[model samples]
Target chain A: MKIFQQSSEFDYSWEEVSTSNWRKYGPWNEKTPHVIAVDTISRTIDPHTGILRTERLITCKQSAPKWVLSILGGQDTSLVYETSYVDPAHKKVTMCAMNITWSDVLSVRETCVYQPSSSAPDAKTNFVQRAEITALCGGWQKIKNSIEQFTVERFQQNAAKGKEGFEMVLEMSRKVFAEQREMLRLQQESKILQEARI
Target chain B: MSASLAPECNQVKEQYDNCFLKWYSEKFLRGTATSDECESLFKQYEQCLSKALKARGIDSMLREAREDNRENDAEHMRPKP
Candidate 1:
C-alpha cells in the first residue's frame, strides 16, 4: 500500500471555495479534458445536522501505459464513485472517492477536506487531500511494485493539473457572480425609480 | 455544467443541478432550507441514469463499491473540527 498526502490553501472564503468546487469541471477548464461524465446518483440532507450528503460517479477516459494495458486487457476508461458531505453549520466539506473500475487489481481511494484557514479564516480556505493506493498482482511482486510506482507518478501529475483547473473555475465563477450581483442591484434601483414616478 | 453519464438524462440533470445550486447557496447554506427543492427533478434524472447504468452493467459495480465502503461512510469520514 502506498499513501499520498498534500495540503494547500485557496485565497477565497469557505463559501466561495465550496461553491466553486461544484463547478470544477465546467467548460472553462481545459485541464480536465479526460473527465467525460459526472452523475449525481443520490443526495440527501441530514435532518439532525442539516448537512448535505451527495453521491456521484465520475467517468474518466485516460490511456494507461502500454505494459499495464497489455496486462489488463486494454481498458482505458475508469469509473470513480465519490461521496461528499457538506456541513454548512460547521463550514466544512469532506469528500471521499474510490475507483470502482479495476478494483480487484489496483485500488485507489482518496479523501479531501475543505475548511476555513486558521490564519485567515474569512479570506482563505484550507484544503487537505490524502490518497491510498494498493496494487495486488497475485504473487507478481515485481509487477505490483511497478504498478504502484507508475500510478503514484500519474496521480501526482493529475493532482497538479486538477488544482490549476479548479483555480481557473474559481476565478471565472467569481466574475460571473459579481456581474449577477451588480445586475440585481441595478434592477432594484430601476424598480425604485419607477415606483417614485408612479 | 457537467454532462450526465447518460446523454438522455442531460436535460433533466441540468435542471436538477440548477435547482440544487440555488437551494444550496441561498437556503441550505443560510440554514433556512425547509425542504429539498430539487428532489423531483433528481428522481427524474436518476431514473434515466439507472437505465444507462444497467445497460452498461455498471450498476452492480456501483452497488458493490458502495457496500464495501459502508463501514467507512461519509458521516464518520469528516476531519476533526
Candidate 2:
C-alpha cells in the first residue's frame, strides 16, 4: 500500500481551527466551485462518553485541470463521504476516513487529524492529512504515479485554502464577539438609565 | 461560517451556528459551557439534515460509519496489557 501524507500548521486558536474543520465547507477555494454541496447525515454526542460523531456527504463536480481530466477521463459529479469523531475535551478530531469513488477502478481513502500544535505557540493548530489510493486493476503503475502527483498538488492547494479559510472564520468570529459585547454594554446602560429615572 | 450539507437547512443552521459561536466565545471558552438557547434551533436543523441525507442515500452510510467509529474507539480505549 502506498501512503501519502502531508502536514500543515496555521496561526489560529485550536478552537477556531478545529471548529472550521468540523464545519468543512469553509476550506474550498473559489476555483473549486465544483464542490456543489455538503450534507450532514447525522451528528450525535455521547452523553456518557463525551465523544462527538458526525457524518457528511459531500458532492463535487469533477473539474480537474485539463491534463488531469485527460489522464483520468471525464468524471461526473462525485460524492465524497466522510465521518469524523471529535474529542472535545482533548481538542482532537480524527477524520476516520473520507472515501471517494474516483472511478470503477480507483478508490481513495483520506484520513486527517486536527489538533493543537505542540511546537507552535498556544494559538496554533496542526493539521495532518493522509491519503491512500488503491487501484483495483493491473498494469496501472504509470497512472498511479500521475494520480499521486495530482493528489500531492491537490493537498498543497488545500493546505493553502485551509489556512486562508481558518483566518476568515477567525475574523468573523472576532467581529461577532465584538458585536455581542457591544449589545451587552448597551443593555446594561439602558438598565441603569431606567433605574435612575425611577 | 460553513453552510449545512442540506442547503434547505442552511437558514436554521445559520441561526443555530450564530448562537453557538456566540455561546462558544462568550460563555463556553470562558468556562461556562452553557448551551440552553441553541438547543431547539439545532434540533430543527438536524431534522432537516436527516431528511436530506435520507433522500441522498447517505443515511445508511452514516450508520455504518458510526458503527465502525464506535468499534475503533472501543479498541483504542481498551487497556494494553
Candidate 3:
C-alpha cells in the first residue's frame, strides 16, 4: 500500500472555500481537464444539526500507459464515488472518495477536509487531503511494486494540478458571489429611493 | 455547473443543482433552511441516473462501497471552536 498526503491553505474564508467546491470541476479548470461529469447520487440533511450529506459520482477520462490499458481491457474512463459531509455548525467540510473502476486490480481511496484556519479563522481556510493506494494483484509482487510506483508518481502530478484548478474555481465562485451581492444591494437602494418618493 | 454522468439526466440534474446551491448558500449555511426544497427534482434526476448506473454495472459496486465505508464516516457536528 502507498500513502500520499497534502496540506495547504486557501486564502479565503471556510464558507467561500466550501461553496466553491461544488463548482470546481467545470470548464474553468484547465489544469485538471480530465473531469467529464459529476453526478449527485443522493443528498440529505440532518434535521437536528442541519448538517448536509451528499453522495456523488465523478467520471474522468483515464490516461494509463499502453501496457496498463491493455491489462484493463483498454478502458479509457474511470468512475469515482464520493461522499461529503458539511457541518455548518462546526464550520467544517469532509469528503471521502474511492475509485469504482478497476477496483479488483487497484484500489484508491481518498479523503479531504476543509476547515477554518486555526490562526486566522475568519480569513483563511485549511485544506488537508490524503490518499491510500493499494495494488490488489496477488502473487505478483514485482508487478505490484511497479504499479504502486507509477500510480504514486501520477497521483502526485495530479494533486498539483488539482490544487491549481481548485484555486481557479474558487476565484470564479467569489466573483459570482460578489456580483450577486452587488445586484441585491442595488435593488434595495432602488426600493428605498422609490419609497422616499411616495 | 457540473454535468451529470448520464447525458439524459443533465437537464433535471441542473435543476436540482441550482436549487441545492441556492439553498446551500442562502439557507443551509445561514441556518435558515427549514426543509429540503429540491427533493422532487432530485428524484427525477435519480430515475435517469439509476438506469445509467445499472447499465454500466456500477450500481451494485456502489452499494458495496457505501457499506464498506460506513464505519469510517465522518463524525458530525463536532464542537465549534
Candidate 4:
C-alpha cells in the first residue's frame, strides 16, 4: 500500500500572511523612529510579468533606503545576510558585513500600507508587500564596503576617491558611529552657527 | 553618472546591484539547473513581460531604462549564482 500522497504545485503556494495596521513596528524600538510602515493590502507578488510584484504600500519620507524600507526581520523571512562586529585596536569601531546569496526565497506578500488619519491625504506610500527574498553572496568585508559606499555616495560629501579614499571615509565613519558623544558637539556647533547667522 | 566620480560610483554599484539581484535570485527553486534553465528563466521573464506589454506597452516604457540599465545588468553575465 502506498503511504505518501502526491501534492500539486498549487498546494505549495502561499496561503496568506497579514498585519493589522502600520505603526512603528510595535516591537523593534531602536529602528522604529527611522521606520515607516505601509497600511496594507494582502496580495501575492504578481507573477504575471514573471516578476514578483506585491501590492502593499508603506508611507515614508521619499528619502529612505530600500533595504530599510523592508519589513522587520520576522514573519518567515531570509536576510540578505549580514553581521556586525566591534574592532579590537580601535575598540569603539564597529564593522558591518553584508553578504549576497543569489535567488534564495519566496516570501508571501502580506499587508500593504496605510497612513494614520491625521496625516496628509493623497500622499503616496512607496512600499509593496515583500513576497520574495535573496542573499547577496558576498563576504562581510564586501558587504561592509557596499554600505560604506552607499552612505558616502548618497549622504556625505564626496572627497572619497581611489581605494584609499574609500577606506579613509569608512574609517572616519566607523569612529563617529561608535561614539554618540560627538553628536552633541555637532548639534551644539550647528546651533551656534545658526545663531551666528542671525 | 559623474565622470570624475566613476571610481567611487563603480564601487557602490557593484554590491548594491548584486544585493538587489540576490533578492530576486533566491525567491524560488533552490534546486540546481543547467545553464539553459537559468537563461530560460530570465528570457522567459522578458517574454512574459513582452506578452503583457501589449496593453500598457511597458516595452516602450522600458526602452530608456533598458538602455540605461543595459551596461549595468550586462556586466553581471558571468553566471553568478
Candidate 5:
C-alpha cells in the first residue's frame, strides 16, 4: 500500500546532494514533466541601492494521474485512458544546474545572500548554499511583491515551482544525514536510556 | 508568453507542492503517515493541478489526448486541443 508523507523536519547537508547525477536526466524544458534548476551568478554586497542582477531557472514535472482523471470525469465521459511517466510514489529529481553569471558588483549578490563573499563554493560550502537556497525559497512567497522586476517575480514563481523540487532533493540527501545523526543520537540516547535502564 | 498563470494558479501550485512534499516525506522518509493520507493527497494533487490548468485554460488540450488508459477510463481522456 502506498501513502503520501510530508517531512516537516529537514536535515540540511551539502555533500549528499552534490553527488546526484542531475546532468544525465534532463534540462529545464519548462514544458516537460521534470523539475530542474541551476544556480545563478550572484554576489552579496551592500552596494548603494540599484537593480540587483540575478536569475535562476527551476522546472518540474507533476504526475497527477488522478487529476488527469478529474480532468476527464468533469468534462468528457467518452474518453478512456493515457500512459505517462508519472509515478505518484516516486520523489522527483532535478535534472541540470549551472551558475555562470558571477559578477563583481555587490548589489547583485543580494539575490543569494545578504552579505558579500569572494570564494566560490567548495564541496562543504556547496551544501550550505543549497540549504540557504531551500530555506530562502521556502519563505519566498511572502517577500515577492516587494520587488519590481519581472526577474524577482520570476524568482518567486520558480521558488514556488522548485520548492518541492529542492525539498525532494533535500529529502533524499536528508536520509543519509538522519542515519548518521541517528547513530550519534543513539549513542547519546543509549547513555540516557541505560541510566534509565539502571 | 501571453498565456501566463493567474495568482490563483500560482497559489494553488504552491499549496499543491507543499502537500506533495509533506505527503511523500512522511511515508517514504519517516514512515509515519498512513496509506489513506497518501491516497487523499494523490486526489488533491489532481484537483489542484486541474484548477491550475483551468485557470490557464490549458485543460482542454490535456483532456483530449488519445491514449490507452483514456480508451477505457473515459475520464482519463483529455479533451481535444
Candidate 6:
C-alpha cells in the first residue's frame, strides 16, 4: 500500500528544515498522544561525499482508532529498525530500508526531499514526503487488505501530526537562535565595558 | 513519541540538541558553518547513547549497517575507468 504521498512548505530554509526533521523525536500531539522515539544506534559520515548514514531504532505509538486496531491486530507500539541516508548537499533524507516488527507487520521505504519553494517569494522549504508500505501478511489477501487500509489511515493521521510537530520544532529553533544572539550581544557589551575600564 | 533509548543520556542529548538546532539554523544554514560550540556535548551524548545501544543489543545491527554503508560508499567512489 502506498501510504503517504504529500508535499508541504515550511517557513525555514531547506537546510534548517532537513536538520530538524533528521533529529525529530517525541509526541506530535498531547491529547491524542502518538509518541515517537528514535534511538541512534550508529552514525557514520562519508569523508568524500559528506553523506551521513544513520541506523536508528524508531518506536512509534500507534494511536489508531479502535476500529482500525481491531482490524490490524497489533501491539500499541511499533518498533522499526531503519537505516537512513542523509545527504545534506542535496537536502534529502531517505529511509532506504525499514523493518517493522511486533505490530501491523510491514516494511517501509520512504524518502523526504527539502528544497526551496518555487511558488513562495519569501525563502521557504518545500518538503516532499513519500512512503511505500508493504504488508507482511504471509499470503493472506484479506489480512493484507486490512493491514493496508489501516496503514493508509494511520499515515494520514501521522502526516497531520508531522506538520504540527515540524512547526513546533521551527519555533523552538527560532527561540534558541534569539537566545544565542542575545547572549553574544551581552558578552560583547561586557567586553567593551572591561576594555573601557582597563 | 520517541524518548531516548538511554534515559541517562537524555540530559546531555537535550543540551546538545538545543545547541545543534540553534547552530544549524543560524550558523550552518546562514553560511557560517565552521562552529564547534556543541562538539563536547555531542560527544558526551554519543557516549551515553552508545552504552544504551549496547545494552539493547542494537549495536551489532548498527555495526552491520555501517559496514554496508562503507561498502556502498566504496562502490560509489570507485574510478569509472
lDDT of 1 at B74: 41
Output the chain A TM-score of model 5. Answer: 0.25
Candidate 5 runs further than 4 Å off: A1-198, B1-7, B10-12, B15-19, B22-34, B38-48, B66-81
lDDT of 5 by residue, A54-133 (tens): 21222222332453233222222111111211111221121112211111100111111111111422222221112111
Which of 2 and 5 is ahead in DockQ?
2
lDDT of 6 by residue, B1-81 (tens): 246756787787678767865765566445565545777887887898888777866667556545545544454333333
Which pairs clash inside model 1?
none
Candidate 4 local lDDT, A125-194, one digit each (tens): 1222111122233456555345444433432221111112323333343454447456656667797755
Categorize the docking of model 2.
Answer: acceptable
lDDT of model number 4: 0.26
Q: Please provide, for model 2 over B1-81, each residue's C-alpha lDDT reduced to its tens digit, 9 standing for 90 to 100.
A: 456657788888778767865665455445465345667877888888888878976667556555645655564333333
What candidate 3 gets wrong by more than 4 Å, as runs, is A190-198, B74-81
Q: Among all windows of ten consecutive residues in candidate 4 chain A, which has the lowest summed lDDT?
A: A11-20
- Tell me the fnat of candidate 1: 0.60
Ranking by lDDT: 1, 3, 2, 6, 5, 4
Model 4 misses residue B43 by how many Å? Answer: 7.7
Model 5 complex DockQ against the native: 0.02
Model 6, position A142, has a per-residue lDDT of 81
Looking at model 5, give its docking quality level. Answer: incorrect
Counting clashing residue pairs in each candidate, in order, gives 0, 2, 0, 22, 36, 7
Can you write out model 1's per-residue Cα lDDT over A7-44, one digit (the tens) per residue?
A: 99999999889988886876867798888888999998
Clash count for candidate 4 is 22
Fnat, model 6, is: 0.48
TM-score of each: 0.94, 0.71, 0.92, 0.18, 0.27, 0.71
Clashing residue pairs in candidate 6, if any? A26-B1, A27-B1, A35-B1, A36-B1, A36-B2, A37-B1, A37-B2
Q: By the TM-score metric, which is better: model 2 or model 4?
A: 2
Q: Which sections of candidate 2 miss by over 4 Å? A: A23-34, A65-75, A119-121, A137-139, A190-198, B4-6, B19-47, B50-81
